[model samples]
Target: MKRLFFQLLLVSDLNVKDKLFKSAIAIFIRLTYFVSDIAKEKAPQLAANFDKNDLKSVETVFKSGLPTPDEYAREKVKALASNFDHSELKHVEPQVKTNVAVIEEQ
Candidate 1:
């Protein structure tokens, strides 16, 4: 069961990593805002030191080769899937549905 859960978590096509990355950024932004509010109340001079441009420029430090979480997950999943020939498990193709359905509660 644990292995199955782990495999699902590492499923590349599900875009779990992308969703996780976005969620993490949202949480970080909220935490930053909360911290800044506290800093502004306790120490205005210290809080003033944080500049938006300085923070924005921090992204430049990361190299171009830096893979986003989704890319990393895809690579890992691909590697794992490649090794499945040795195991008893089989890879299943994903299915797509074009129709949509909506049911409202009474």
Candidate 2:
């Protein structure tokens, strides 16, 4: 059982890492494009074009590689698993009442 649990964690961890890496790459690409766009316009300051969208420069960043739905949901799943791991249920003590009496049948 322990081995199975670890295997499951390992698989899920791999998936999360892949998704996270792709998402990081997407963000980096987007930031790079955004900067290049600002430089293209010969803007004196960043505030002038800070609100402009740069998706035009790298259109595939969002459509091809990103933090997909699976990535979003699995992150929460991992957090819930961590919470279960640290829960007090494993250390909980059974509460019993000593006042109960046993009756003998005649």
Candidate 3:
């Protein structure tokens, strides 16, 4: 049963590192939803932790959503080119470099 659950949680489309990150995000979202539902049901006061705007954002994501990866990448490139700030690049470059290094190491 444990093995089956683990397998079910795995997303085979992603390579190992991506798979792990995706799995973690997926688990976090599931846990968040579960806790939110419990709070809404049993302890209404706890639901205040997730504000109206946060709930609306989640609902919009589920209903409307972000673009496809290709579209998102193209838009990101356009935004980066237009905004083109060295300060932002400093923040972004390290994360990209770290992710690339980790993937390569794996």
Candidate 4:
């Protein structure tokens, strides 16, 4: 069937050795995007000031060994908690609490 052939094509496109390489490449791309988005959000002034050269520099740094957004977020939160009296852990707490309450009620 046409569907089966397409599936076969997808699978055969990558051998075992290349599969790992492709997966790593995919993960890197995803992490780069995540880091870029977080950087943009948290440092809007810096992001706004970024020229084409700046973007290229960021891309180069990210491709080398930069941490992903999730890693950056964790470090940033820890740093803020340690340095400041007031800490904000607002995003996940509410969703987790709501999910627990729903499960208990059910």
Candidate 5:
């Protein structure tokens, strides 16, 4: 009985979160799918980053519109800085911005 109720709660929570997250994202982003990977390591950057911590970063990034990489992401998100990426040098951009910024170079 308890397990069944937990499952029901999870479903409803997902529905509410889906609606809310989509509605918020639609306000600003207009993204499209792209193919990127190597050998057998292929996945969407956004989804891959969000999946870092059981999808917690999904809620954080989606809510704040931050293209955050895992471990660099925040939780309980609210408003973010317009220049959120400028964590250090204000006059120059970082060589490596985020996890997805640069996959590799040879």
Candidate 6:
């Protein structure tokens, strides 16, 4: 099915052996789990930004090895906000708290 194919494609891309790709995927996977609402908000931006240049940014976050997924997502989001200079960055903290509460209840 087309849906399955797309899912496979996404997963394959995420599983790339490159450290930067892995780090970005870590961030994305964590977003999918802990903060899915925020993930939804970020996915499109991530898709658009997932390029050679963005990999440099992701790489800059990890001097030695990959960080935890939450840390990756936070840095990635902050990087995105800095590039955009948008007001949406202001909403992320409150959403993070709400999502944490939701996860705790589960």
Report the C-alpha lDDT of model 2 over 1-106, residue by residue, as the tens digit.
3455455556656766677655665566567678878787786665565754675546766576767899979998998987785346544522212223222321
Locate the minimum summed-lDDT window of 10 residues in model 3.
Answer: 5-14
Alpha-carbon error at 84 in model 5, in Å?
Answer: 93
- Candidate 5 residue-wise lDDT, 37-94, digit = tens: 2423544555567645756877776879855566255432333555466646654555
For 1-106, candidate 1 gives per-residue lDDT tens digits of 3454344545633665587765565566567678868877878765778688876567665655598899999999999988767433332212112122222322
TM-score top scorer: 1
- TM-score per candidate: 0.29, 0.28, 0.26, 0.27, 0.15, 0.21
Please, what is the whole-model Cα lDDT of each candidate in the order they appear? 0.62, 0.62, 0.74, 0.72, 0.51, 0.73
- The local distance difference test score of model 2 is 0.62
Candidate 6 segments exceeding 4 Å error? 1-15, 37-106
Lowest lDDT block of 10, candidate 2: 94-103
Off by over 4 Å in 3: 1-17, 44-106
| Better candidate number, 2 or 4, judged by TM-score | 2
Clashing pairs in 2: none
TM-score, prediction 6:
0.21
lDDT for position 74 in model 5: 47
Predicted structure 4, TM vs. truth? 0.27
Q: Residue 20 of candidate 5: its Cα lDDT? A: 64
Q: Name the better of 2 and 3 by lDDT.
A: 3
Task: Candidate 5: list runs displaced more than 4 Å.
Answer: 17-106
Error of 6 at 89 (Å): 68
After TM-score superposition, the amount by which residue 13's alpha carbon in candidate 1 deviates from its true location, in angstroms, is 63
